[model samples]
Structures are given as C-alpha cells and as structure tokens.
Target: MTSTKTSLLGLTRAELESFAVALGEPSYRGRQLYLWIYGRRARSFEEMTDLPEPLRRRLDAAASLDRLSLVRDTTAPDGARKLLLEMSDGLRIESVYLPDSPGNTVCISSQVGCALGCAFCATGKMGFYRNLTAGEIVDQVIEVERLTGARLTNVVLMGMGEPLHNYDNVVKALHLLSDPKGIAISRSRITVSTVGITPMIERWCSDDPPAKLAISLHATTDERRASIMPVARAYPLDDLMKSLRRLAHVTRYHVTFEYIMIAGLNDRREDATNLKTLLRNIPVKVNLIRLHPTGSDLQPSSDNAIARFLDWLRQEGIRCTLRESRGVENSAACGMLFAQEPIRPSSTQRRTLDTDD
Candidate 1:
C-alpha cells in the first residue's frame, strides 16, 4: 500500500527546514537533511547516521522516502540505459541515461503519459494518465544516479509529457534539481522541450525560467504542424512564433527548434526555406532529428535529404545541428518511450524489473 506519511523527496531546503521545525527539531536538522538526501543520496532514514537515533525513529514513523520501483530496465548498445519506473499507484514512466562525451545526461518525464497526441511520439499514443508530483519528478534524478553510478551533468524534460502541461510541478522540480544544496545541476545545462504550448511559453519567460527551452517544430506551416501535432491546431503557428520571439528577446538562452525530418513529408528544400522565413528575426538554433520509428507508417528522411536540409540552413546563416540518434536498437531513442509491455495489470499486480516480453 502507498504510504500515508509525508514524503520529503521534493521539498526545498526552506520547506525541509519548516518540516523540521514542525517536528520539534531545530531547523538545522533540515539543512542536514538537505545534505544527506541530495548530496549523500540517502534512500532511507536509517542511512542518515548523523541524525539522532530517536529523531530518526520519529522520522521513520511520520515520514516516508517513497521511491518508484524499477519495473523494467534496458541498456542500449551505446551505453544508454532506459528505466521503466512504477509509481505507488502502479502508473509507470520512463527515464533514460545517456553517457555522452564531456558530460552525462538524464532525460526525465513530467507526466505518466501525454495528452498532446503528437503523431510521432510513442508516449502520446498512450493518452494522458496523470501528472507526476514534484517528488516523483526529482526522484527520477536521484534514482538514475543510484542505478547508473554516474553523476548527471545535464537534464532534459523531454521524456514522456509536455512539461508546460504540468507547469507548477515542473517548475518546482527545476528549482530543486538546480538548488545548490540539492542535485546542483547547472540551470544552463537543463532544457525543457514542449510541443509549442504558447501561453505557457509566455508564462515561463515572464517567470524567469530556470532551464532552456526547446519547441517541436517538425513542419514549417501550421497546416502541416497541425496534421502531426494536434496541439498545433489549438495554438496557431503565427501566434507561437510571436511568443517565441518575445521569449528569445527576454531570456538569456537561445531558443531551440526541434525539427523531425520525415520522408516525403517535410524534408524538401522548399520546407527548409519556409522554416528560415518563419524563424527570421528569432534568435534560435535548429536541431534536425531523423524520425525514429514508433509503429507509424511514416519513414525517416533519406541521408541525402537530411544533408541538403542541413546544408541549406547553414548556407542561410542559421546555426543548426543534426542530432545523432542514440539507443535506437533498444527503443530508447527519441520518440520511443512507452510503458505498455513493461506494466502488467494482473490479479497479483506484480511486475518484474528485468528484460522480458
């Protein structure tokens, strides 16, 4: 059964101090907790050796350090590890670890599934289940560190859900993750990807965003973007660009537009020119991603098509990069995270954390 006790995983240091004060302990105890839970990576109160035995016992009874149970773990040949984690209520989410050069990066989810039915994303096919708590979000980082034994130098909220849909919790988790007393990841190293939620983009810009922004711009025209991403229909491309222009002006970071190149769909030279016109005055970078298969009839752009597209953008003086697909063999690459087979809803409600069908 899920514990009724309070969970201290996502609490900020000030909140932790308040919790300690409420428990009749000095506020310093909370600061110590900040050290242990994040820095020392303590999983249980018993591991907090510096705390008093009686206080630890009291904490054990009144609080819980609940963790997502690892339901299934897969490692790609490229040393990328994908974890399907089961929450207290049995919902599952995927988090991935990519051991990149210069730094290690962890990609985490903000919600169980997704509501934005993006045609290329496997997670969106599952539909929206629920938003993950701030604790659940932060714990993905903690759990990844424990499982991989690698310090994550970068974080991306690009796993399963559109982070702006779960704005408050995502913002809280961002602060906690970048807090000096906590995981201490640099805000500049963190990026949040969205499928163009315009109002939320404005709100994020106004609130002094902690992480960088990446918006999915698979197609240059509104009609084409709406054809693939249903959310695009709600917020038109023109309005989205206006907000992005403002965001680019206000934020210190350059906006990144993620374009998925699909065969015979949006990879033509004309599309590249249209994209250039669309992002004319915006300070931005383009990341061209070859579409990864997810049971869709759509095929990836040909090598020559991608090269031409990249060459055209570079020739136009736009900063662009072609993202190399990693973890493709194990279904852990971009747009490939789903929890269908990993979660088993049976009479016993038991699930294994090993590789299985």
Candidate 2:
C-alpha cells in the first residue's frame, strides 16, 4: 500500500468483515477476502479474482498482503523442510514442514528470537530480538503450506520462541489461523508450546476454543528446571502445576508435557520417578524428546537412557512417546534453527525482501 497500510494477512475473520463493511462493501466480501488471503494463499490484492476490479484496485492502494518473504527453503532427506522467512525489518525467523505419516505438521515461531535463555536451545542463545506480530506468525503457516503444496494437519508454535512469552500476539495468531472462514484449520489440531508460563496457562483456560497446550517441561524439580530454564525461577513448577491442574479440569484436555532427554543431566532413573511424582495429579501426556545438540554442552540421552525413561513412564501409566528427530542434517531439528545468521550460519541462511521492494 502507498501509505504504510497494514497487512491483512493476520486479521481475524471478524476483523476482515468489519474492514469490508467500513469500506462500504457487503459483509460477504469479507469471507471472500479471507478465503483469498489464507484459503487460497493470495500474495497480492490483484490475486483476489472474485472481487470487482475497482474494489481490488482500491484495496491495492489502501491495504497490503505483507506475507513472509521466502529466503531459503531447505529440505532434508527425511522429507522435513525448513524455511527461512524474512520479516520486513530484515530480521528472520524459521518455520518447518514435517511430512509425518497420517498427518503433516508445520512448526512456526512466535518471536524473531527467543527471550527465554534456555541453556540448551540455540534460539535462546541468540538473545531476544522482537515479538513477531500476528501477521508474521500466521504467514509462517501459509507460506510453508504453499512451499510444500500440502495442507498442514497440525500446527505447533514450537520452532524458535516460547509462545507464552509473546502471549497476546501468539494467541491472536492462533485465532487468525483457526478461523474457519479463512485457513479453517481446526483448533484441536493446533498446539501452543511454552516454557511453562503459569499465569498465561491459567488465562488460556478461559478461551472459548483454545488450541491444545504443550509445556517444555525439561526438568522435574524446581531447582533443576531453573538451572536450565531460568523462567522456572520466576514461575516455579509447584506454582505452575496449580494452574495446570485447573486447566485440565476446565478444558478437559490432556496437556502435553514436552520433556527433552538430556544425557548425564536429566536422564537419571530418579528423574523419571520424580517427574512421575511431579505430574501425579495433572492430566497430561509426555513427549520425550532426545536433546538436539546445540551450542550448549548438553548432549542427547543415550538410547539406553531414553528407553529406560520411556519404559518407566509407560510402566507408571504415564502416556509417553519418543518424539522422532527430523531435519537433523539441515540443522532444523529441535533446539536448533535460530534467526541470527552469525550464531547459526548454516540453518540461518537468509536474505531480506522489504515489502516495499
């Protein structure tokens, strides 16, 4: 748009309808516009074929698509594709497409870089850049879908930043993505992963149709969790668990606990027992992830350690599964994929394309 007009990419369906009515157009035009932007992945106002030519031209001058600029799209041999999406300000973020059987997943970032300095995460090591707007967040899904030519069956906000840190924008992006009039992905298929921000979890319980919740619960004890995840100090496990229990009761959903199995650190048999005790009353499922190597000294738990932990969890009646590693060779696996080029030169291969360009 000529005068720094806002991007329509991230607006909820209601907002689009309101915008259409404000433009002296019929309300149905909003749904049409919504379908064009997300359902059809329209890149420009001119691409909305159903709209009248005059209206399209008017929109061209007053609004913009402002979707992500694709920089580098890398695919590993395992059918996982990682995309480098350049923001208008030149900061970059990553989104990934994983072609898992029976379902394809697109993992997206909610912030340019992560504010939470988790000891084992490559993204947190780069430090915080800025919170991605709702538009930037949704564009990750739309662009990844276009790149892979497959509709995403599941969406995870688990790529770069902790979702709860950028709470409002991430929630807004969820509303936009799950809107049936637009992309129409079911809310049940969306999962928001956070580093256990307790207050935010409590807030999400009131959402009418909340996306499922996933916690990056890498440790069982408060002291141990704080060593790697500094946020745990501010929001301790015991305090966070109170809200988690309430969430399960109110939402009636099994909250996902994502535990990264780290070697010689969190892989102890005692840790699994402690974890089971910690989650005793909470309605939850556990995803045991092998720690992906990062700049930190953390190493993945050995196969024996992993199996022991999985077996223990199952024996204790905890629903747990080992998360399959993907895109390891392309540096797109868990805990990898940061936006800063220098910090992660290989996976961070990116260039900028300003919307004005």
Candidate 3:
C-alpha cells in the first residue's frame, strides 16, 4: 500500500529541516534529505542509502517522494519531446523539451488549463482548470531530467497556462529551482514569459530574482491585441509597455518579445514599423515566430511576408531574429501543447500549412 503522508517534493530546505526535527532526527538530516531528493534525484526514502534504516523507514511511513506521474510522452522528428504530466489531484499539464547545442530547454506549464483564451492557442481553448502547486512545477524538471538522463540547462514557464496568473506558485517554483541544494539552475537561464500582466510584471521587476523575461506582444496596437489576447483588455498595451520599460531598468536583462505572425492580420510593413516604435525605448530582442497551424482560420504569415517584416525591423535598427519553427510534426511546437486532440484543420487550412517553409 502507498503511504498517505505529505509529499516531500513541496518542502523547502527549512521545511525539510522542520520535518526532520518532527521525525525525532537531527536538523542536518533534513539537509541530507534535501540533497538526496533533489541533488541525487532519489525517488524514495529507501533510495537514500546514507540514512539509517529505522529513520528511512520512519520517513517512508511519514513522508512521500511521490511527485508527478508521467502520462503520455511524444517526440517530434526534430528531437523535440513533449511530456503529459499528471498531478496528484489528477489535473494534467504539458511540458516540452527542445534541444539545442547549448543544452536541453524545458517548457513547463503552470496551470492545468488556460483562461487567457488567446484565439490561436490550443491550451487556452481547453479552458481554465486549476493552478499547479509549486511542487508540481518543480517536479516537471526533476521528472524530465530523470527521463532524459541529462541536466536541463534552460527552462521557460510558457507552456499550457498563463504563468503570471498563478503568481505565487510560479514564484515559489523559481526559488525552488534556484536552490543550490536542489536543481541549482541559474537565474539567468530561466525565462518566465507572460502575456503582459501589469501588476505581476511590476511585482516581478521589483521582487523576483533576475530571470529572463519575455512578453507575448503579438500585436503592436491595443485594439488588435485585445482581439486575440483577452488579457490586453485588462492590461492595455500602453500600460504593459510602461511596466516593461521599468522591468528593463530594474532587471537590466534584455527582455525578449515574442510575436507570432498571422497572414493578413498582423503581417504587414506597417505593423513592424509600429512594433519598432512601441519597443523603441525598451531594451528588447524581437523574436518573429511562425504561427503553428491549430485548426484555426488564422493563417501564418508567408515566408516572404516574415522576411519583409524582419527586413523592416532591421532597417529600423531594432534587434530581432526570425525564430526557426520546431516540433511541427508531433504537434509539440509553440501554442500546440494540448492534452486533447486538436480540431482537424479544414482543407483550406491544410493547403496554407503545406505552403509554409
């Protein structure tokens, strides 16, 4: 029978110390347990060979190492892998890993489902379920690390849900990852992307560690932005830009701007010029992303159209890069992290996708 004890995955070093004290053990035992669980990647108290048998048995009966249960694992031909992780409460989330020369990058979700309802996102269409606990978020990295048999160098909280919406848990997860006794990933390596939550971004700018920030600024104007990203109605583009400027000064990190081009909608020379003016004062690197076809009426901007926009930005002296599309085969690319089968694209949609380079 499995133990009904509390999960050890959520406890911090101090909390672990307290647990050790409660277990009638020395304070150092908590530190040892912390290292064993996160540092050495022990999945059970019995796996901790350093501890005494009785104490290990006691911990075994009192605390659980049970974390996320792997549900479905799919890999794209390009080597991008997406994992569907099941939380203790049966809520499911998706985490994707993208490989590059530097190291592996894990894109982890913060919520079960998303409420943002961005017109192009599959996860958003699933509707909001619940926010994931801090332990749930941290366990994703641990499980992914264990599965891949290698260290994950970079992490981005831009998977299935709006991370800033689940502020506290996401922040807690950040600290947990930075814990030297645990995952020990550098602050600079983690990127927390948001769809422009003003208050949260301001709070992050002031209080949070120096994690790289990225804003999903798909549209240059407020009217157009609000159509796709409903959050724009709550936090207008003007206000969001102000917070981003403050963020640039506070973090001194060049914020990355993610812009997905939809043909005939946000793809135009004028849009690029407007985007340039909007981010002119902010220290940012613009990433031009091709929209992943998701059975939506929206068409990704053509390759020529993307080139034209990049050219316009370059002419305007803005730092930018047209991001290469990844994981299109297994449907693990950006905005494609869905637990359910996506709606089939129409015949017209298929033709448009086939033309994409």
Candidate 4:
C-alpha cells in the first residue's frame, strides 16, 4: 500500500516554505497554499485555482491533504453537533461543535481513545487506541468550520484522550491551530485539559506555552481522587499541586479546575471547603460540571447539590462557574466521545481494561 506523504496543514510557515522551495515552487507559494488550506478551507488541491495543474499534481504526489473521514454526524436538540471521524488508519475519534453567544466552540479529541481511567467516562471504557497526528487534529477544526460556516473561537482539548498523555502531538496541533498564517486562533482561546500528568505539567510550565491549562481535578484529597481516577495514584494531589503552583507563579492565566459533580460522591460542603483549601493560593477558577449519565456506575449530582457547592465557593470568594451540560442527547458530554466500531489491532496496541468503579 502506498502511504500518503506528510500533510502541509501541520507544517509551520518556515517548514511550509521549505517544502514549497523543495518542490521547485517559489517561496510565496507557501503562503498561498496556507491560505488555500486554512483561509479558504479547501479540501482538494483542485480548489487552489491559481496554482498550475503540474504543481498541483506534484503537491498531490508529495503529500496528502486528507486526514479524517466523517463516519457519522449527530446534531443534538440543543443545536450541538457531534462528529465521529475515522482516521486513515481506521481508528475512530470524536469532535463536538457547540454554539455560544459570540461564536462557536469546537471540542476536539487528541487520541483515538483514552488511557486515563476516569471512573465516570464512557471513552475511558474504549481504552487507548492511538495518538492523533497533528494533521488529523487540525482537520477536526477545518471540518467543523465547513459544517457551521463560522470560525471556531474557542477550542477545548477535553475529548477522547488526555491531552497531556499525547503531549508532543497535542503541542504540534496547537502550534498549527494558533499559527497566524493558518487558523490564527489566539492561544488564549485554546484550552488544553489534562488528568494532571505532573512531569508534563512541570515541563509545560517551564516552557510556558501560550494556551490555557485545565486540570481534571474531581477530588481535592489524594485518597478520594485516587478512588475515582487511577491517574491520581501515579501523580498524587500533592505532587500535582506543586506543579500547579509553579504554573501559577510563571503564567498570568488562571488555571481552571474541572470538578465533575458525581451524585453521593464528593458533593458535600466539606468537599467544597477542601477544594477551596486545595486551590487557596493558586490562581485558579473552578468549573463545576454535572456528571452526564453514561450508564456508568457513577450518577449525576442533583441541581440542588450543585447549587449548594457553588454557593459555598461563592461565599468563600472563589471564582467559580457551573458549566451547563450540552449535547447530552448526542453523547457529546465530558468523557463520552468514542467510536462505535472496533479498532484494528496493531503491534504497539495498548488496551483499555474495565474498572470496577
């Protein structure tokens, strides 16, 4: 089988220029191609009208512009759309486009499946398939833009896999998405969510990338967190807090803690107080997410419970917001994205085993 060449969509401007020059095309061709791919949202080489047919053929021969195939699309009653995208390798992932006041927000997946076994996540049940290439990640946005006819103002890496687990590709995708000559979305508008992988967090803080950071911190205490999320055992709350402190000191942006309200689990006033203490000195905002029913062992916390928790936080002067669950009818809720088909086995395959929780 002939493998497709590297895509131009994932390349930096310098890299794109190098590729164009190597192809015997002028340097300016890179900018034109970039605009064609991103600005015009062209899917085929034929859409690049200004380029000569021979050059277009050369480009087609050299690299593939295609990355994802839209396998299924479902629109929620609330107007949210979820897409199940099949990669070239036959691995499946999901992306969601949600309408907001000013613009739309696209929630993109970074991997085929998830490695972090968060108790309440349906995608976690699917297990880790593979990390998405930068081109595949960028393609999700391009496809969403095509469907909606509006530029994506906000991007959240809170889909199928842990963004920190697939750090390199996720970073590459961010650079591609935020490139001025490409999508040009502000880094401030992009948020990368992680399950608190300590080393990567430390590295990210030290390197200081422009995008915002969000930690999936369902519990404040290590023991309780470990009970719900297996990742907590690897990177305990104390260690996670140390890394968060470094991130706070270095970056001006406020880190958001995603606290999923699971009914009869971690919904007490004491839990809220513990959360306040945990984030006491750190520059942070709390996003209270009501658990979406995934037919899992966990149940959603009641609205009254969520209100009580928010009331406590507000009274304590912590910046907090109750995030409304969108696309619940479409299985686009937090940690719910997974392809319906089976993944093809590979030599380097990693399986996701079922957990009791």
Best by TM-score: 1
Q: Residues 1-357, candidate 1: write the lDDT tens digits.
A: 756788998888898999999999999999999888887889899999999999999999989777888988999888878999988877899999999734999999998778776889998777667788998999999999999889999999999888888899999999988887788999999999998888888898899767999999999888888888877878888898999998988886789999999988898888878888989899899999989989988889999999999999888789999998888988889999987664444324422211110
Highest lDDT model number: 1
Judge candidate 1 at residue 150 and give its lDDT.
Answer: 93
lDDT of 4 at 66: 72
Against the hidden reference, what TM-scores do the models get? 0.94, 0.92, 0.92, 0.93
> Once model 4 is optimally superposed onto the true structure by TM-score, how far is the C-alpha of residue 29 displaced, in angstroms?
2.5
Clashes of 2: 0
Judged by whole-model lDDT over C-alpha atoms, candidate 2 comes out at 0.82
Ranking, lDDT, top scorer first: 1, 3, 4, 2
TM-score of 2: 0.92
**Residues 1-357, model 2: lDDT tens digits:** 336775787887788889899889998898888888877889998888889999999898778888788888889999888888887777789888999744989989987777677888888766666778988998898888888889788998989887877778888888878877667788999998888877777788876445888889998888889899877888878888888888889988888999999887788878878888889788888999888878787777899999998998887789999988899888888888876453333334332211111
TM-score of 4: 0.93
**TM-score, model 1 to reference:** 0.94
Error of 3 at 237 (Å): 1.0
Q: In candidate 1, which residue pairs get closer than 3 Å at backbone N, Cα or C atoms, i.e. clash? A: none
lDDT of each: 0.87, 0.82, 0.83, 0.83
Which segments of model 1 are wrong by more than 4 Å? Answer: 1-3, 342-357
Candidate 3 local distance difference test against the native:
0.83
lDDT of 3 at 221: 90
